[model samples]
Target: MTMSDDIVRMARAWIGTPYQHQASVKGVACDCLGLIRGIWRERHGTEPETPPPYTADWGEGGGQEVLMTAALCHLMPIDRQTPMEPGEVLLFRMRPGAVAKHLGILSAAGQAPRFIHAYNAHGVIDSPLTTPWQSRIAARFHFP
Candidate 1:
């Protein structure tokens, strides 16, 4: 299968994982970054590099594109202006003037695009990419 297909397959396996800070386990728990880490491990055999401990306001303080930089280093950057397809990884800015800190895997396209992501209060779940969510998207990438 294609790498994107593999990514989607692996992400789907994390569907029921409980959301937890700094956690990464399919049946147990994981956060947004954890979900990406898990998918990377499954596809690439090992994590490209270790991540340092980060706070809840990790990049918010400096408004740095920490996650975006890491994604460019490990993942293939894509055109954000173009329409997104299934299996693409999306980086989102939760709000204006805030660092982009959220991530999700696009799972469907066309009339109603859906994405799967792990949230703090709610575990991993797929939600439609409604208008509100679309406006927050900052970038998109694909697994290599």
Candidate 2:
């Protein structure tokens, strides 16, 4: 299977993990970044860089795209204007003009693209890429 497929599969394996700030563990707990970190660990063996402790509002308060910047530093950037693909990483802004701080892994593509993410109070879930979610996508990427 392709690396992207592996990443998608790994992400799916973490479905139902409780959402926990700064934590990363499949079937246990993880935040949005933690979910991505866990997938990276399973696919790449280690994180490119250790992330320092960060607040939930790390980038929003400063109006900085901290998550997108980190993604560009590690993953390969893709056209945000194009349709998504399986295994692609998405950066979400949550609200207009806000820093893109949320992340989700695309698990399906084509007719109905689905993304897997750890949502607050809901834990990990794979949801349809509805228009509401699509409109908030700030960037797209793939693990190198």
Candidate 3:
């Protein structure tokens, strides 16, 4: 199977994992970034590095591009203008002028696109990439 397909399959396997900040264990608990880190482990063996402890307002408080910076360091950065495709990692800003902090793995691309993410209080779910959500996308990357 292609690497993108492998990523989608692995990400889907984490479905139902509860959201737990700073945790990356599949099925047990994981936050948005945790979900990405877990997938990285599954696809590429060891993680490049472990993330430091972070609060809910981690990037917001510091105005640091923590998530985007790490992603650029480990993943293959993709042009934001390029059409999003299945298995791509999506970085979201969450709000205007905020650092890109949220992450999700695109599961389907074309029309009615969907992505899987660990939503707080809701666990991991494949959510529709609705217009509102689309507008929040700040960057995209492919697993290296």
lDDT of 2 by residue, 91-141 (tens): 998899988989999999888879999998999999998989989998899
Global lDDT scores for all candidate models? 0.87, 0.89, 0.92
TM-score of 3: 0.97
Rank by lDDT, highest first: 3, 2, 1
Across residues 1-144, which tens digit of lDDT does each residue of candidate 1 receive?
876677778888899899998888888999998999998888778999988887766579888888878988998888867778889999999998788889999988789988989988898988899989989988899888
Using TM-score, give the best candidate's number. 3
Off by over 4 Å in 3: none
Stretches of model 1 off by over 4 angstroms after superposition: none
- Tens-digit per-residue lDDT, 14-133, candidate 3: 999998988899989999999999999987799999888888775688798888888889989998778888999999988899988889999999989999999999989999999999
**Each model's TM-score?**
0.94, 0.94, 0.97
Q: What's the candidate order when arranged by decreasing TM-score?
A: 3, 2, 1
Task: After superposing candidate 2 on the true structure, give the runs of residues whose Cα lies further than 4 Å from its correct spot.
Answer: none
- As a TM-score, model 1 comes out at 0.94
